[model samples]
Target: MNSIKPKFINVLFSSRLIEVLEFILEEPKTKKEIEKTLKISTSHLAQVLSKMVDMGLVDKRGDIVKILPKGEFILGVNRVAKGYDEFLSRFGNFMNTYILDDIPEWLISRFYELAEIEIAERREDVFSPHPEFFEHLSNSKRIYGYVTVFFKECINFFLRLAEEGREMEIIVNKGVLDKIVENFTEGFGKGIERKNVRFYVSKKDFQVFFYCYRCFLFDILLFKKCFFLTTRKIFFANLGWVIVPNSKSFIKAIKKYAPDKLEEVIK
Candidate 1:
């Protein structure tokens, strides 16, 4: 049997249709119940219901209105669409900081799963979260990420973490890795011999000043700090960090970037 193709764009874009579908999704109700719930006139409610029934989305029996399978499917798609819309609205500022023109829309949409994104402002003379990010790195059992910028303080802590039997797989810029080889070669040697640390240099030219330890992920932007405008750059006092707890969706998103594959590509 051929399934009917619903023209769902109208339902997706129309708030009235979305609202009516949501109400019907909760439970089947009568026309009077929908009219009262939506605070719409009887004529308007009748028109909406009639449109839905003609589209094979709703079935009306006497005074009762029930959503059919087609209606339920449309509702499911709309929910996901709304989720992505909400994400873009809430994180417009955060996402706008990056040049994502080359990134696929599907991958960008998955970023909506990053819940509880936070933005904090810092001044030149005040404390910053660099210490806290490093502290969490030291506390974590395993760490994995790409780092385009290097700090002696952070390298020292990675050494300590390796010595403490923590596992780390890091991809760093050539210059950053060179600095580590110069300053921490002995520590890196010990870490490598113990099989607790592995490092690779990025083949492509790009900056990666961030960290990921277990469920916690951080990004440091490279913009300078100003007294007036908030900056998204890392390696500066005014930095923005995006942290997300472990969720299946989040894990799937990180995996798409294929940090592991990047590791092999470098070697």
Candidate 2:
């Protein structure tokens, strides 16, 4: 008697063929039975069963075909394959509907390309968060900078730290001052408490000229979304500072270059 090898049995485990075998496992069935149960055509079912017979996965007697022990093993592999396919399908749909819905189309295309390039380059330092970056800022006594767009995540994080007694001095673009004023007022609550968060609005385009002492920069250029957040390591070796749209140079340059854009944001 020839010994049945696992390798030979594994060859019959294609996803489509496994579905056919599973139908037979539920009940010993002929080619016609498999065709009706699996919704495969007669010709396709015959071709697959023929291959399985050669691999010792199915035993055929007259019109009836039964799944062998080897066939059962292949069915197990089919279950795993089907499970993985289902998981990926659901996950893909979720990302398409939720996480990606708000993103602009042009940015989406660029983001995907950038992701591929980032994966290929395998640069470890790219977006790896350095706690020391924030630590240095917290230790600094004087901070001078401005921010544009006023990202909520960055503001909230900094505000939480400031509430815990960290001193942070920042300048913001005119476009964001009103909103920041509201957040600062609400965050710290009435009277002199809100004064701790000193904010200035500049008459120039803050986006083009803000600089920080702690030189850290990150750009998120997604479709219809182009923003950069940078922290500069200035002064002390371990201490750094950040700049936003309200930074002195930032305001000065905006006044010189794009003064018209600043008219609405300035105090």
Q: Indicate the residue-level lDDT of 79 in model 1.
A: 72
Per-model C-alpha lDDT, please? Answer: 0.59, 0.50
Give the alpha carbon lDDT tens digit for every residue of 18-70 in model 1: 78888988789988899998998999988988899999888999999999999
Candidate 2 lDDT (Cα, whole model)?
0.50
For model 2, residues 85-121, the per-residue Cα lDDT tens digits are: 5544533544443344443454344444333222121
RMSD for each of the candidates: 12.7, 14.5
lDDT score, candidate 1, position 57: 87
- TM-score of model 1 vs. true structure: 0.44
lDDT for 233 in candidate 2 is: 25
Worst 10 residues of 2 by lDDT: 231-240
For model 1, name the residue pairs that clash.
148-208, 220-234, 221-233, 221-234, 222-233, 222-234, 223-233
